[model samples]
Target chain A: MDPGTVGKLIAFCNNGQMQVPAPEPATDPRRHAADTWVVIPLYNEISVIARVVGELAAYFDHIVCIDDGSADGSAASAEAAGARVLRHPINLGQGAALQTGFEYVVGRNEADYIVTFDADGQHRVEDALEMLDLAKSQDLAIVFGSRFLDDRTDPGWLKRVMLKTVVWVTNLTTGLRLTDAHNGLRVIRADAARAIHLEQDRMAHATEIVLKLGRTKLPWREYPVELLYTDYSRAKGQSVLNSVNILVDLLVR
Target chain B: MNVMWIQLLLVVGVITVGLFLARPTGGDSHLALRRLFMAAFVIVAILSILFPQWLSWLANLIGVGRGADLLLYALVLAFLVFVATTYRRNVATNRKLTLLARQITLAQAATEDSASIHRPHEGTSNDDAAH
Candidate 1:
């Protein structure tokens, strides 16, 4: 079978019943109109998180940070920078950390729209409001941020291919048709956020959520968002080889 | 002959004791009964092995020498069946508990997700829903 078709099948399987529209010309995030809360799940992001928090504070009304048992002062720094902070007793994986933030927001009845933002400073907070706008106009339940949109610049040859392959595979499993499937930045309605239960404890948890969301008949959209990788982000990250472990985990469970 | 009478009485006493100790705890009661039955069977086996002549004499006095051996075989088979059934039930219960735990965790995540999205914050500015 063609790789593209396989990817779509895989995505469809994972997404359950969610529908993705045919590809169209790229557009900016600012065109949507809903209220949004920026949620950043962090673990030892004390190095460059202040700027990420500041940028989000400038654009969104609510900023939530989950300190996933970081030994460093990442939680305090994020709290000091004005984000509502929640701390895990021990190091849960990023999925658990994101769940904690999602729970906190839902518990307080604070946000109608939720955006999962990375604390590593690779995401541009300025585009957050734009994504919010897009979500509102389209009445989308979930909006994934895409770095591989028609108008967006590709990060590099390696990253571009790697991300595209992941997107294709995810589409095959979940039935979601996204250009940048693994992009961490995503905006979702609070109801959809609550309905999609994620049990994955690590990075694979993101895939789990996307797959579950696709299974539901909820409405979703993919919008162009920017990724700015600095020296700091590259130094702290693991290679794409780690995806092997995620695949193994998914299969075993 | 006197010793043989005492042995017969001992076996009877053990059987009686086993039935008397059975409780009403449903599943465990049956398990306990099986264990007691096995223990009685072990005692009978040891007595027969130690004094085959006495059993033979007692079997004749009871007018059924072969019936005693058949009863012993029945007890052995019953013990084996009880052990197998217990093990199978335990394994089945463990699997059910695992599935239940997963459901509970997912339900918790679902509840948390809903609460965070709907609950309003007191101090936080209400950003308009992007549309």
Candidate 2:
């Protein structure tokens, strides 16, 4: 299927949903929201994590934040904002936090889907909700959010080049062609999430997750989603030089 | 200039070790092989120190110039092997640590979840009282 048409289709569906005025509770597309868990691997984002969790709590009934031993009270802030907080005693990498979240969600019998979100407030809740809807409607086991599907997200030229290189490397390793590899928004069904065993504990886990998920041979698709590259997120973004570390981590293992 | 036999041997040895490092390590057999290699190295080191002339004679047979040069080459190869083994060990250790930390975090979260479920209303009342 052509991604261009799919992108336009998504835009059209979004507009259709917006035009609806006071739909009945029975007709709400988000009726299954209770079965979806939003897993956020939070770090030292005390400033914005409360707002992020609060925004997610509006749509998702279950929001779990894995606090990787933040020096700041980010965990408490997330808890106050109505999220289930899991605290790691020591600071592990984001990948480790993600794995922990997956395991925690998978242990519960009620969870049917996991939406991996970022704590930096770059990801849009509407995008996550749409991805989850696409997954359910299409019977997809995974829905990856891609920024390059449209021109809405414009990371700087250098950052774009670096991200494209990462996409190339991820495709080479995972045997799955994806427009964006490092976006922190993904919708993984419970079955697909159970298959992921991420050994890479650092930034390399992004590629590792794709590699493991691809090995499952489950039905997957890329959904066009715009990432809000705010100043806070930009400041916390990965540096180009860090790609060397990611390469080494992936190769050595 | 013709390449000496020692140069060819060193190149082949380094290449073989590099390829070996790339392979997934076997558990018991790999440990046994490493121990055997260490034992052989110790014997050779003692022999070289005890009879320096014998070391030079052996080095000449291998086309190396002197006993010191042969020892230097061996030391460099041993250092590389040490680095490779240390790196592998570190990766394995990190994996174990990650699993342990995850277990602890999950257990704590589960306990807190049960506690809140049992006294669900008390938590909200405490929050309201604090506010």
Leading candidate by DockQ: 2
Per-model DockQ: 0.03, 0.62
DockQ of 2: 0.62
Write candidate 2's Cα lDDT for A1-253 as tens digits.
4676567556646653222211112346456568999999999999999999988887889999999999999999999999999999898899999999999999986799999999999999888887877788668899898898778999999999999999899999999988889999999999999998888889999999999999999988888888999999999989999998988887766
CAPRI-style class, candidate 2? medium
Fnat by candidate, in order: 0.00, 0.72
The alpha-carbon RMSD values of the candidates against the true structure, listed in the order shown, are: 14.4, 5.8
Local distance difference test, each candidate:
0.68, 0.86
lDDT (Cα, tens digit) per residue for candidate 1, span A89-159: 66767877777677667665768999999999988765566566556655778878777665455567776
Candidate 1 global CA lDDT score: 0.68
Q: What is the alpha-carbon lDDT of model 2 when measured against the actual structure?
A: 0.86
- Candidate 2 chain A: worst-modelled 10 consecutive residues by lDDT: A16-25
